[model samples]
Target: MYVIIVYDIKVERVNKVKSFLRQHLFWIQNSVFEGEVSRSEFQKIKNGLLDIIDEEEDSIIIYPFEFFSEVERTVLGVEKSPIDEIL
Candidate 1:
């Protein structure tokens, strides 16, 4: 599945979350990531994030799609291509 993960975390732990997500997704913007991940991989990512995030002070939003083609993306400025495939 294709996934878009956005997060707003406390400044102190922001880098921790950012780095964690980078391992599983492509960084497209400040707090936005998009890429493809398998079900198991997604679950692992979620579990990892849960361990690192402070639920009361941070927010993470994940949007999953059945197919990448189903998403309509628009880039007005510099275009950062999403990862074509997960290795």
Candidate 2:
């Protein structure tokens, strides 16, 4: 099954994390990254990530959702939807 992994990380460290994944991963997107792999590969990716990230300098929160509904349920106001939407 396809899954969506959403991450919220520090602004400065975002680019470094994105760049690292782009080398070993496909389907890269803004803040959200998606790809398909075996269970073993998935575990390896997680471990590889931890090795490079510096906890004092940056932090990453990752969540794997089985369905789009779960993602939609957490939606905040859209950025372009309105000027006052976030206010």
Candidate 3:
């Protein structure tokens, strides 16, 4: 299954989260990161995100088994595509 993890992160902390995902995930596109990961891997990613975010100021959306096109379309207005690749 595929995942589309969206985020509404503060500007300053975006890079940190992006860097973290870049090291772990495959085919990251926009703020919507894509990858085929085991349950444990997903949890790891979630944990990593939680550590960087302030919770009150920053937000994230993690979608699993999502269609690529739907993921792409959902983020039309989000406008921070740091990641773009095919899994």
Candidate 4:
């Protein structure tokens, strides 16, 4: 499945969350990540995030798609960290 994660975390834990997400997704923009992953990997990501975030201060939104093609992305400005697939 493909997942897009958008987060608004406290400054103290912001970098921690960012670093964790980077291991599983493409860092497209500030606090935004999108990529494909296996089911097990997805579970691991959620678990890891849960361990890092303080529920009272952090916010994370995850959008999961069965196929990447299903996401109709529109970039109006400079695309940061664009995904370039060679396949």
Whichever of 3 and 4 has more TM-score, that candidate is: 4
Across 1-87, the per-residue lDDT of candidate 2 in tens digits comes to 234454556776677767766654553346665554466766776776677677776555555555534444334655332322322
> Could you tally the backbone clashes for each prediction?
0, 0, 3, 0
- By TM-score, the candidates rank as 4, 1, 3, 2
Q: Residue-wise lDDT of candidate 1 within 49-75, one digit each (tens)? A: 999999999999999998898888777
Query: Which candidate order results from sorting by lDDT in descending order?
Result: 4, 1, 3, 2
Query: Which pairs of residues collide in model 1?
Result: none
* Model 1 residue 68 distance off true place after TM-score fit, in angstroms: 0.7
**TM match of model 1 to true structure:** 0.87
Q: List the residue pairs that clash in candidate 4.
A: none
**Model 1 error, position 10 (Å):** 0.3
Q: Rate the local accuracy (lDDT) of all candidates.
A: 0.87, 0.56, 0.73, 0.90
- lDDT leader: 4
Provide TM-scores for the models: 0.87, 0.51, 0.70, 0.93
Worst 10 residues of 1 by lDDT: 78-87
Looking at model 3, report the run of 10 residues with the lowest lDDT sum.
78-87
